[model samples]
Target: MDSQADLADILAGEPERIATGFQFTEGPVWHSDGYLLFSDIPANRIVKWTPDGKTETFREPSGNSNGLTYDRAGRLIACEHGNRRVSRTEPDGTITVLAERYNEKRLNSPNDVVVKSDGSIYFTDPPYGVSEAERELDFQGVYRIAPDGTLTLLIDDFDRPNGLAFSPDEKSLYIDDTAHRHVRAFDVLEDGTLANGRILVDMAIDAQGSPDGMKVDTAGNLYVTGAGGTWVVSPSGEHLGTIVTAELPANCAFGDSDNKTLYITARTSVYRVRLKIEGMKTF
Candidate 1:
């Protein structure tokens, strides 16, 4: 299938942000309450951006939080690289630990996360957020957190899984393995197990630095972070045109009233662009 699309067709023009002043940010999530929550990794805090452009701190020393998502209950789920765990922010702003260890060893670092309709949590763990010794886990893994608070290791073999997202139908999962310069796809099994893992898109060594974060649109188009800009791909692994921008984008999500706003987390700043294709969150 042809997976290429001109980003210019969907986006009316360059994005106008709702917030700013972060030190190296990543992981952006849009909530039903009309607020955007994101992480400033180096600054060690989670910040909120309202539709009116007001910004506020969500969490202090956020364990170098890298990714954010919301469960069915509207609670904020965060992937903390510094603490090497995934946590949830309660409605009252209190924090709750979701997963920290597996098989008696601490995780390397939870890099990104996404929630399923059934209240299951899936996340990627890499070593970028951990010290050499503190990361006890030998291999980076993609894990699942059941509603009952059980942790299941989905995949243990990955160079460095950075960002991830599920297909609109939830039958497929797309994951970014940065070091290998490729995005892999997995078939989601009936029991929430993943199988048939294969390389979905092989990124160029020079054209794209590394795929960091990604999002899928309503039509199953995949928008991923690359060196130059965002690489738009099809669900079947075809390469689409790049979403050109000033800064190197790290991650993205569909937000705004119609879910047509693509919020991107770049180097030290955040940006947004309108997309012709609304994101899967709205689909």
Candidate 2:
């Protein structure tokens, strides 16, 4: 393939609309079994769509979930906005609460989540799900849940922490602040703690979108949902370009057997595009 053509393969064609008519869609994840699962926040449920064009409900009253991912053991991990907690759905179809309170106060709302290879669960807690009167936490935070079920506050300085992901090597963690319109990187310490936080990218003041959800490819490039569409940034923080979508995307994930297909969850719909690059495997 021509070099340019090879690079252009990141998007096979116009984004294919898999389904529509949802109240609001977010948190798309591809299953190895040939289907994609995503959340319809306002509908309070998770929907599954197959490659063959089948759509069905995977779970109901999904706590108004916003983000979803699979753990090493194939359990479903979710960030619930309505319930203001992070939970895991076991293979046996049981739901287990992972994190809900910090220092005896209820969380503002768990907005996005990702699983580390070491079995640690990381998620962002913003107050988007509840009103100021119902929010018990004073500040938004990024939290980590250890394998032993211990919850630790990783960072609490963000105005609105929305999305999070780890570098391919797991040596760094990236967290985005919607209110600040910037993404920050942190060094992952040997003890599963984070330090050395710094701004990775500053969206231009005139940029069209605020930073929301993010994912990293195998090559360390970040696909972050922001103004105009998904902003693609190199591992070194260089602006590559943006993937424009018909609707504002909330989150994205690489799926398919090859992990080269990007599934996007936008308002009222879900879309997918085939990319030449593959996503970093969570397992």
Clashing pairs in 2: 208-227, 209-227
lDDT of 1 by residue, 181-249 (tens): 889999999889899999999885466468999999889988899756788887888776777666778
Displacement of residue 243 (Cα, Å) in model 1 is 0.7
Give model 2's clash tally: 2
Taken over the whole model, the C-alpha lDDT of each candidate is: 0.85, 0.87
Q: Using Cα atoms with residue i matched to residue i, what is each candidate's TM-score against the true structure?
A: 0.94, 0.95
lDDT of 2 by residue, 1-283 (tens): 2121334635565567789999989998877777889999989999999988889999998999999999998889999899999999877899999999999999998999999998999999989999999989899999999999999998999988988999999999999999989889999999888999999988655656799889999889998888777877788887677777789888888888999888888888888878878898755
Where does candidate 1 stray beyond 4 Å? 1-5, 16-19
Positional deviation of residue 171's Cα in model 2 after best superposition, in angstroms: 0.3
Candidate 2 residue 202 Cα shift, in angstroms, is: 1.5
Name the runs in model 2 displaced over 4 angstroms. 1-9, 205-207
Q: Candidate 1: what lDDT?
A: 0.85
Angstrom error at residue 115, model 1? 0.5
How far residue 168's Cα lies from its native spot in candidate 2, in Å, is 0.8
Q: What TM-score does structure 1 among the candidates reach?
A: 0.94
